[model samples]
Target: MEPAAKLDPITETALRSLHDIVVPAPVSWWPQTWGWAVVAALLVFAALLVTLRRIKRYRANAYRREALTLLEGVADKLRHPATRPDAIRELAEVLKRTALAAWPRDEVASLSGDGWVRFLDAHDEDRTGDTLERLLDDFEYHGAEIVAGLPSNVCSDLVIAARRWIEQHVSA
Candidate 1:
């Protein structure tokens, strides 16, 4: 190995005076301007409004949820010939109650026969009132005989119409 040569006094003095480079601090995550902060606040407020609207809508439809649960039981009963008559009556009652829940008592309570059918048809998006009319009009009075005479698909069609009415009826 060769011996190292020493620097001149002037060069050594200049080298000793030098220091390491200084780096600036990292950038902040917070908004740099008031406009950015305002935009962020508005976005948060819009999200909160959307969340609250969804919660209010869910709470308002509580009756529909309950009616749907009741309809499931009615559907189970309708599967058997013995229980079909009573289930039809209960199904009609559920539809009436659901209408009452979404509309004023005076408007829905007095409705029956054609008036009831019209009311159901008016609110139903699919206009399935005809399918429900036979069940509502006859099942209440004729009892088991009427249900016995009905085609097998009648009960299932009634159930589908009722479900559609409950789900799509407009609120007054």
Candidate 2:
């Protein structure tokens, strides 16, 4: 038993030598983790920008379709004599509203007082510039008095005129 106790010191030295060769682990892994995070964030941002442009295009297309529909409906209604003054005014208002929705409402509405005259005329086939006001006036103030009542043929002509004007006015 005395001989066995004496052997312990050599065994301890061998065990310590084996442990020294192994390297310790790092305390932090943030640098490597953050590199991956940054790349992911950039990809997300790129995707978002593309999505936003597509959404804008889709909205614009929808607005164009809606405006065209409104104009078409108004033209169809105008294809008859005895068209109501109220209906004409309403249709004009719809066109105005649709224009405002597509463009700037305040600016377009203000154009009504002055520049609007030229704006309309610019799109007119004749370039008379006062056609819009003339048409509107006919429906609003003159329809009941001067025109008395819109005849189907007369209304059809007006419908054709309006359709032509709108077709030329709106951009694709």
Candidate 3:
């Protein structure tokens, strides 16, 4: 191998005079323009609005959630033959109380029989008033002997209709 070449005195002096390249300062995290800051603020404002609307809606439906829980208890009672009649009565009461909670008392308190069922249908999105007719109108007030005469699916259908109404009824 050839021996390393020695740099001339003038070339060595020139090389030593060269310094490292200068690095620019890091870019700032703040926006470059006022318009970009305005856009960012608008986005944050819109997000806060959407979040507040969702929270308000959830709070407004607290009664529906409570009614659903009561319906579940009635459904459990409906499973037993002995409790079926009383459960039907309780289910009707639950519907009435739920309606009272969502609507004015003058509109819901005095309703009974067909009027009550009609009120329920008017509020229910599914219009399941027919399914709840007999249970709410007659059987709710009848003795255990009358309730025992109901078709086997009647209790379940009533429960389902009640659940649907509780979940989907519109408030006044």
Candidate 4:
């Protein structure tokens, strides 16, 4: 064979089999390395937001929670067969303390007699203030008498009214 006719072995193989350039398939976008971390971060952020909201709600109602607990204790005391005469006074003290808690201490701490009753009704949407005032008037006269000694219905009504006052107050 003429030297010029002798084919290079590599060139001969390339000529025997030929196809389009074999480009690798494009990289898939899914199954990313950082996806789980991103999801975990979002979940943590959402949990933080919910936790903050729960904490805020609990703090804002702390006074209401405390007042209700105190009222329940007073009611339990008044429910006994040999209840003390001072339960009325106790209820009055609870009301005053609740008022002081819900409002500026300076505003409610100095209130007395009718002024105190009026202050209570100031926040009362039901206008039970007059009745509460009458009850308070009776309180001064009625010291720690047993629940049976006084008009039981009236005393019970007073307790209910006091509950409403604490529950319905606009502020903490």
Model 2 regions more than 4 Å off: 1-59, 80-82, 123-133, 143-148, 170-172
Candidate 2 or 3, higher lDDT? 3
lDDT of 4 by residue, 16-131 (tens): 88877899999985657788778888999999999999999889778778878887877776666366355666788888887777788888898987788778888887777866
| Best candidate according to TM-score | 3
Q: What TM value does model 1 have?
A: 0.89
lDDT against the true structure, per candidate, is 0.88, 0.62, 0.89, 0.76
Estimate the TM-score of every prediction. 0.89, 0.50, 0.91, 0.63
Tens digits of per-residue lDDT for model 1 on 117-157? Answer: 88888888877688888776776668587685667688888
Q: State which candidate, 2 or 4, has the greater lDDT.
A: 4
| RMSD of each predicted structure | 2.1, 10.7, 2.1, 9.9
Clashing pairs in 1: none
Worst 10 residues of 3 by lDDT: 145-154
Off by over 4 Å in 1: 1-11
